[model samples]
Target: MRLSRFVSAASAFLLTAALALTGSGPAHAAGPVYVALGDSYAAGVGSGSYDDSRGGCYRSLRAYPRLWANAHTPSGFSFTACSGADTTDVIKRQLGPLNASTTLVSITAGGNDAGFVGVMTTCLLNSSSACLRRIDRARDYIENRLPARLDALYDAIGSRAPAARVVVVGYPHFYKLGTSCIGLGASKRRAINDAADLLDTVTAKRAADHGFAFGDVRGTFAGHEICAGPAWLHNLTLPVYESYHPTASGQSGGYLPVFTAAV
Candidate 1:
């Protein structure tokens, strides 16, 4: 038997009332509407080829946003998400274009909030112990600063698309460490997991405070994490991907379930 998954559900009332400014019912209109907001992860980097003409942010049709769009067919989607956005970027640039007609909004952010990519690169290639030592110093920042930033983001989304059900996503582990995909040690892997958990906890708490849902991709990605069972990532040993990120199948196979549950 397939194991059942736990999906946290929130009331449509909470979202609808929040966005009452947008009007209501069939009078409102038809179709599934969505506005995506976030960084490279949300933009589909490393999964497939992005539009080079659109910059290095390689958004693929298979990206979760597109998958989500397809799943919600007959609906319109406005993808304002960018590849390198931090919390501030989401608030300033991504949120404005969104409107009350939007029924769903999915976002993954805050990794860039602390230069997360740089930390990951350093840890994956350098002395894992030392790299984590540097990252640990910012644990408090993740715990505290990140929550405030997310709260600000939530507030901004409400101001624009009050009725949209917001789903904030967490980052996944990039490397598995110790198993030697890239020679990272077990301790470093734990550090990365810890970092991801910190973000998840904060995102979940803030989402609850604002009556939205938080998509916990971390749990879904377990076992298959970095250098372990299936390694959801590539580029650790490659000239292919300089930055550690998820593989295409991983994005759909592991990630989609989590998102589907939330929806």
Candidate 2:
């Protein structure tokens, strides 16, 4: 019995010494509980491959949220981002899954609220002046009303998931200026891009105020804007809803990397 006790003590001591030398231990943190929220970009609108089970939300299997969940194999993941979700929709619908247990959250909204889709549509079918006017209206709304809505949404998210590391992702530039694009005139494209910049700036500021990390995908999507050779954003497609949104490659190459880095 004495010999056995002495051998066990020596073995434990050697194990401790080895652990100290190797800088290793047996402690393991639980996996993240990730919940994805926001608008069409978060739902992967242009990425295609939508799940029929999700109904009209157009939640795509290739969206960054799913990509992150697949890569990390998180403890839990709830993808509640809808296609046409605005700040109001999120406050009413999307906050259900978030809780204190959630470790990570991602959302990309404000674009729809700012009416960028309408601005793009106006730029497409109407005169350059008309498009500019529409963009101006959108900018007015974004600057004035959208801020309060965002603050409310961010505050609600915080209330629901206080412990979560919220990553508020912003949109990318839709077009590359100074390029000879056949669709819209150069001036129209420039105005649209400028509006996008304004929207991103506003969203980033609100996110910062909420102590949330803003995953700006603009850098990753720099060279991939429309008319930048092979674009990641769709110009116009058969499914009109997919227009002005990111392609599958955009979700994978553009959004996934930024989101992963943010997380």
lDDT of 1 at 180: 63
TM-score for each model: 0.81, 0.91
TM-score of 1: 0.81
Task: Tell me the tens digit of each residue's lDDT in model 2 across 1-263.
Answer: 99999999999999999998897978677789999999999999999999879889999999999998999999999999999999999999998999889999998999889987788888889998999999999999999999999999999999999999999999898898877887999889888888888988999999999999999899999999999968999998869899888999999999999999998
Runs with alpha carbons beyond 4 Å of true place in candidate 1: 1-29, 175-181, 235-242
Query: Model 1's lDDT to the true fold?
Result: 0.74
lDDT of 1 at 91: 88
Weakest lDDT window of 10 consecutive positions for candidate 1? 1-10
Estimate, for each residue in 142-252, the C-alpha lDDT of model 1 and write its tens digit: 876878888888898987888888888777766555566555677877787777777777778888899988888877777777678667766464534425666776678
How big is the positional error of residue 153 in model 2, measured in Å on the Cα after superposition? 0.3
RMSD (Å) of each candidate, 1 decimal: 12.6, 4.0
Measured by lDDT, the strongest candidate is: 2
The most accurate candidate by TM-score is 2
In model 2, the runs with Cα more than 4 Å from the true position are 1-25
lDDT value for model 2: 0.92
